[model samples]
Target: MQKTYKVQDDEPERSILARLITPDQNPGDDPLEELHGLATTAGTDVVDELVQRRSSADHSTYMGKGKVEELRLMVQKHDADLIVFDNDLTPAQIRNLEKATGAKVIDRTELILDIFAAGARTHESRLAVELAQLEYSLPRLKRMWTHLSRQAMGVGMRGPGEKQLEVDRRLAQKRISDLKAELKQVEERRERQVSARKEAPTVSLVGYTNAGKSTLMNALTDANVLAQDKLFATLDTRTRRWNLPGWGTVLLSDTVGFIRDLPHSLVASFKSTLEETRQADLLLHVADASSPTVFDQIAAVYAVLKELGIEEKDTLLVLNKIDAIHNPAILNRVLDRYPNAIPVSARSNKGLGCLIEAVGEALGREFLDIAVEVAPSDGKLLGYLSSKGEVLSREFGDESTIVHVRMPAGAMGPVHKSALSIKPSTLMDEAKAAEEASANSSEVA
Candidate 1:
C-alpha cells in the first residue's frame, strides 16, 4: 500500500541546485556545470552548486552520509526547494534523499526530461516527450505511492491500496502504448514524406547541443529556425531547400542536438525525428571549434550516432564557431588531426563558400549531365528543368529550344517520360579530346 500524490497543474518557481562528482566507473565532463545549465534552462533559479570527490556513489543516497548532511546545510543556507543530482538515482535513493533533506529530489535524467517537456513545441515532439516521461515514471511508481498507509487484511477484508497501485500502473502502461501507436502513425506519414524526397539529396546537421547547428542551417538555407545559444534549444526537425552551384537543390535539415549521456528513453522515443539523420545522404557532424572539450563533444555525438546505427554513414566534420576562437594553432591542430575537416564560422559567414563547395563536390559525384530540347511554347517544362537542375546552356532554334543541364540520377525518371527530347550529354568531349591530344604528342616524341 502506498500514498497517491495529487498532480499539480502549476507549481511556483523554486530555487534549485546540484551536487555531482566524477564517476569512478567512467571519467568524463564535470556534470555539475551541465546540470546547472539544465536547471537554468528549465526556468529554475540555481542558487548554488556542490561537488565531491568520491570513488563511487553511496548505495543508499547518491552522496556519502556526511556529504548529504553538508548538502542539507547548503540547502538550508540557500533556501533551496529542490536538490538535483548529477547522476541518475534508484527509486530508493530518491525516496531516502527526499526524506533526509525535506526537499524535492531530481536526477540528471529527470532534469533533461523536464527541459524537453518545456521545449517541445510540435505535436510530434510533444508525443515523444510524453512517451519518454511515462516510461521513466513507470519504474518509479512504487516510490510515489509509498506514503499511503496499508490496511490490515483479515478473513474477507483485503487492502485496497495495492489494488489502486496496480490500477495506476496499468493506466500508465496503457497511456504509453497509446502514445506509441500515435507515434507509429506519425512515423508512417514521415516515411511517406521521406519517400517523396528521394529524388533530392538530403544533408542532416548533427552535433553536440549548443554547437551552432541552427545558426549554420539559417546561414545556409535562410530557414530562420529558432537558433539560440542554449542547450537543446530546438527540438523539432526543420528541412529547407538549399541550392548548390553544381548539385541543384538538396534538402538540409536541422534536428534536435545530441548531448553527453543523452537518456536512452529519449533516444528511443525520438527515433522518428532522428530518422532524418539516419536516412540522410550525408551527415554534417558539426562541432564547436572554440570549446576545449570539442573532441569530447564530437565523440559524444558519434556515440549517439553509433547507437542509432548510423556511425558508418558518410560524414563531413564541420568545425564551427571559429569566429570566437582566437588561436590559429588550435584550428591547425584540429585540421591536422581531421584532415578533411572544414572550418567555418556560421555567425560571421566565414568559410561558408568552401563548405558549400565541399558539399557540392560530394553530391556532384552522383549527378549526371543531360541534353534536352523543349518547345519554346512549353514554359512549364522549361521552368521545371531550371528549378530541378543547373542549366548549363540554352540555345533558341526555329523548331525548339535546346538546353543542357546537370541533375541527379534520381531526377531523370520524370524527364524520361516527358515529351521533351532528352539524351545523355556529350559534355565530356573536350576533356576526352584533350587527353587524346596529349597522348598523341607524347607518343610522337
Candidate 2:
C-alpha cells in the first residue's frame, strides 16, 4: 500500500465577530448594526455582536480590562478570528487589544475604508480610495501592524510568511504616493470637463447612500448607471446632458453618495468629485421614503452639504421609492410629513414628468418682452439680441427693423432702455429661442 499524506488547508478564510462600545447616553440602538451591512459589503461573515456600555471607553483598552477579558472569552466561544470595533480605535488601543484578546482588531473607520476599496470600480475611484486608505493608515502605523501580524500558524494569520512591518509600511507608503499622483491627474481632467459646463445650468443629485439617486438619474436622463441595492455604489461623478422640453438643456451630474459619519480621510480625498454638488445651480435632494430613519439621513446629507458650503443652494426634496409604499394611510402620512415633497417611483418611472417640470420652475428666470426699432445699419444689435435675448417678431419697416424680444430679468434694465416699448410677451419668445438653439445644435451634430 502506498503511504498517503493529507495536506491541511493552510489559508483559512477569516471569521469576524463584531461589537459596539457606546459612551454614556448611547443612541437608541447600536449603529453597529449598520456596520454589519458594511462588513457584508467587505465580504466578511459576522459571527456575533457585542455591545459594551460605559461612561467612557478605557484609554488603554478601548473597553475596560474586564470587558476586554470578557471579549476574549466571547471570541473564543464564537471561534472568531477577527474583532471589529463599532467606533474608531486608536493605534495604542489596537495594539493593546491585540495583546489582550489575541484576536486581530480593526475599527469602524478602517472597516469603512476596506469597503470603499472593495467597491471602487474605475481606476479613478480606486486611486481615490487607495489614497484615502493610505492617509488614514499613515497616522496609525504605530507598531499595530507588527503586533497584529505576529501570529504563529493560525487561520487568521494566513498572510505572507515572515514579512517585516517596516517593509509593509514602506511599500504601502510608496503605493499611496503613486495613487495620489494618479488621482491628481484624474482630478485635473475632471475639472477641465466641468469648466466647459460653466455656461450651462448644472443640476446635481445629493442624498444618503442607496437613497436611489442613481435610479433617479437613470429615470430622468436614460443614463444606465449601476443602481444596486447596496451602499456607496457610485464613487466617481457621472454627468450627462438632460434635455428638458420647455427649460432647455441642463447638465445633470450624479456623484458619490453620502453616509452618516463618513470618514474624514474620504471626505478630504473625494472633495473634487463632490464639488459637482457644490457647483450645482440646483440640487435634487433625494430621500428614501421607505427608511425608518429617513429624516436622520436627510439631516446627515445636509450637514455634509453645509460643511461643503452648498447648503444654501436651491434644493428640492424628492421622496423616492413610492412603489414600496402599500397603504394609502401610510402614503398620506408621508405626504403630510413632507408637504412640499414630490413622491416618485424611480424604478417604474412614475411621476418623473412632474419632477422635470418642478426643476424647470426652480430654474425659472423672470421673462421680459420688448419691441426695439434697430437701425438696419446696426444689424449687429439685432443678431446680438437674437442670441443673448429672445426675438419674438421682427418686421423690416423702412430703414429700421421693429423687433419684439423677451429676455431674462437681468437683461431687462439694459434692453428696456434700448427698446421702443416694454411689455410681457403674449408668446414666450425666450422659450422659442431656446428650442431653436436645441434644434440647430441637433442638426449640426
Candidate 3:
C-alpha cells in the first residue's frame, strides 16, 4: 500500500513566501500554519514566513508599512515564486501586496480555491471549482490581468498585439454565467434524486476535512471511495445503500468535509452538491477525536450546517480516530463534554458497533410505533408493511392478522390512512365503532 503526504513531493515545487498578519485583540489561531498547510496542500514549498501585528488591516495593503517592506525583503531573500497571505485580501490590497512584494500574491481563500481546483475529480466538482475561481477572480480582474496590451515591431505605422487578456476576461465572465446555468440544471437533477430518496431514510457523513468520513462510509456501506489522510479527499457526494440488521437498508452518503474559513465562493458554488447533506434525514457528524482542535472542528461543521439551514436536523456525533488517542483522560474529557458522541476508529474498526447502535437509536427516536392489522385476504398488504418498516411481531388472530411495526414518522400517516382504506369491511366497521367509542369516552371524561 502506498502512503500519501499532506504535502506533495517532486514535480519541482514552487518556493512560497508566506505571512500571517492579524489585528490587535484578534483571537488568532496561527493562520500562518494554516497558510503553510494550504500551500503544502496546493503543492507549494514554503520557504519563509512573516508575521505582523496591526491595530487594524491596511486598506490598500494587508500588512503595515514596515511589515510590507519586511515581507518584500524576505521574498527577495528567498527568491520566492509567490506570496500567500493568512487572510482574505481585498482586490486593492491584493494589487498593492503584489506590487510591493514583486511576487504573485494570493490570500487564504484563493489558496484553498486552488487546492479545490486541483483536487476536484467529478464533473460537478470541477464545474463548482470553475465557478468559484471565476467569482474570486472577478473583483481582482483589473490589476491581475492588466497586461492585455503589448507592442509589436513598429515602423512608421502603429503596431500592437491583440488584447488577448481582455478577451480572456470576457470569456471567463461568460463561462461563469454558463457554469451557473449548468449548475442550476445539475441542482434540479440532484433535487429530483433527493426527493426520490425521501421515501427511504438517509444518513449523511459530515465533519472536518480529513476526519475519516470516507473511511467511515466505506466501513458502513462497503463503498470504495478514496479515503486519505489529507484535506478535502472527498469533494463530491457519494451515496450507497447500507444494510442494517432490523431496518434492512437505508441510504448513506459521504460528502465533502468542512474546514475553517471555507471560502464563501465555494459555499455558494457547491450549495447544490451539499444539498445531499442538507436534505438528509440524519447526519453523522464525524470528528477527529485525536485532533487537538476537535472541538473547534466540530464548531466549524456546525456553523456550516447552520448556514445551510440544516442544523435542526437529527445528527449523531461520531468521534473518529479513537485508536490514536493514547491519553485516557483526554478521551474521558471529550466524552464528558460530548455525552452523546460515540467514539470509533475508522482504521481499526474499533467501537463501530456503538456508532451503528447510536444511528439506530437516532432513527428510533424519529420513527413511529405503528400497530397495523390486515386480514388474511390482504396478505400483499402485510408484505408491503413488512418490507417498508421494521416488523416487530405478527400474530394470527382468527379473522384478522395483527402486525406491530416501526416506520419513519413521516410515513406513518400515509401508511395508516392506506391501511384504513384497505381494511376488510367487517374490520373497517369495527374500527370505526372503536374510534367513535374512544372519542365518546374522551368527550365524556
Candidate 4:
C-alpha cells in the first residue's frame, strides 16, 4: 500500500518558487525564467528558483532524493508556500513531493491551466478550460483519496474507498462527454460562420504568448481586444474587418497565443478556436523583436502550428515591438536571419504601412483583373463591387456602365450569377490603353 499525503491549499496570494531539472544534453535550454513569468501572471510572487542538471528525471520523484531534499531546504529558506516544477509530474511524484517537502506542489501544465482558467471570459473558452481541467484531473484522482486511504485499512471499508474513486471517475467521465458534446455543437456553429465568410480573405495572428499579437491585431484593425503585457491575456477569438488600401476588406482574427510546452489537454480543448488559424488564407507569425530568445519563441510557435497541420501554410513573419529595441544593428541582425520578416512596433504604429502592404501583396495574388458592364440602375451590383474590390475606371454609357475592377477570383461567382457582362483583362493592355489615351490628349492639347 502507498502512503497517503495531504496537501494544504495555500492562500491565493501565497509566494511560490519554481524548480527545473535540465537534461545533460540540453544544458542551455532553461524554462525557469518563462515559468517565473507564468507564475507572476498567475498572481503569485516567485521567491526564488532552483535548477538541477540531471541525465534524466527520476521516475517516482521527478528528481533524485538529494535534489528533493535540497528543494525542501530552499523552500524553507525562501518561506515559499507552493513549489512549482517546470515539468509535468506524475500523480505519485506529486504526492511524494508534497509529503517530502510539506508544501503544495504543482507542475507546468497545472500552472498554465490555472492561467487559462483565470483568463477565460467567453462561454466557449470557459467550457474549454473546464473540460481541460477535468481531463487533467481525471488520472490524478487517486491523490484526492489520500485522506480516505487510512480509513480503508479494514476489509469492509477497503471496498468503499475504491468504489468511491470509481464513482468519481465515472462522474468525471460523464461530464467530459457532456462538455465534448456541447463544444461540438459550438464548433459546428462556428464552422457555419466560417463557411459563410469563405468569399473574404482571412488572416490570423498566431505566435508565442506575450509576443504582442493582441497589440498588432488592435493596431491593424482597431479591435478593442484586451492588450496587456502579460502572457495569455487574450483567449477569445476576435475577428474584425480590416480594410486594406487598394485591396479590399479582409477578415482578420486574433487567436489565443501559443507557448513552449503548452499542455496537450489545453491544445486539444482549444482546437476549435485554433482552427481559425488553420483555415486562414495567411498567418501572421508574430514574434517579439526585443526578446533575446525571439528565434526560440518563433520555433515554439511553429511547433504548435505544425501540430495543427498548418506549418506549410502561407505565413508572414511579423517581428513586433521594434520600438523597444535601442540598437538598429539588433533589428538588422534579426532581419538578416529572416530576410522576409516585416518589422513593426504595434504600440507606436511604426512600419504598419509596410505590414499592410505586405498583407495586400499576399492577398492580391489571389485577385483577378476583370472588366464588367452593368446597367446604371443596378446600384446593388455596383456597390457590391466597389465595396469588395478596387474599381479602376467607371464609364457611363446610354445603355450600360462599363467598370474595370480587380476582385478576388472566388468572388466572381455572384457577379457571374448577376446580369452583368464580365471579361478578364491583362495588365499590359490596360497600361497601353491608358498611355495611348494620355498621348492622344497631349496631341490635342
User: Considering every candidate listed, which one attains the maximal TM-score?
Assistant: 4
Candidate 1 vs candidate 3: which has greater lDDT? 1
| Inter-residue clash pairs, candidate 2 | none
Pairwise lDDT winner, candidates 1 and 4:
4
Judged by lDDT, which candidate is best? 4
Q: In model 4, where is the ten-residue run with the lowest total lDDT?
A: 20-29
Worst 10 residues of 2 by lDDT: 20-29
Q: Rank by lDDT, highest first.
A: 4, 1, 3, 2
Per-model TM values vs. the true structure? 0.78, 0.71, 0.77, 0.78
Candidate 1 ranges beyond 4 A from true positions: 1-16, 22-31, 151-160, 366-445
- Compared with the true structure, all predictions reach lDDT values of 0.83, 0.76, 0.79, 0.84
lDDT of 4 by residue, 1-445 (tens): 9999999977555555555555543323554778888999998977767777777888888888997898788778877788888888999999999998888999999999999999998999999999999999999998888776445455566655677888999999999999999998888777656645644788899999999998998898888778999999989888888888887788999999999889878887887887677667788999999887787788889988888877877789999999999999989989999999999999999999999999988876767888787887998899778755778987788998878888766457678877468877665467659999999999999
Please write out the lDDT profile of model 2 over residues 259-302, one tens digit for every residue: 87788878767877876776576789998887766777888899
RMSD of candidate 4 to the truth, in angstroms, is 9.0
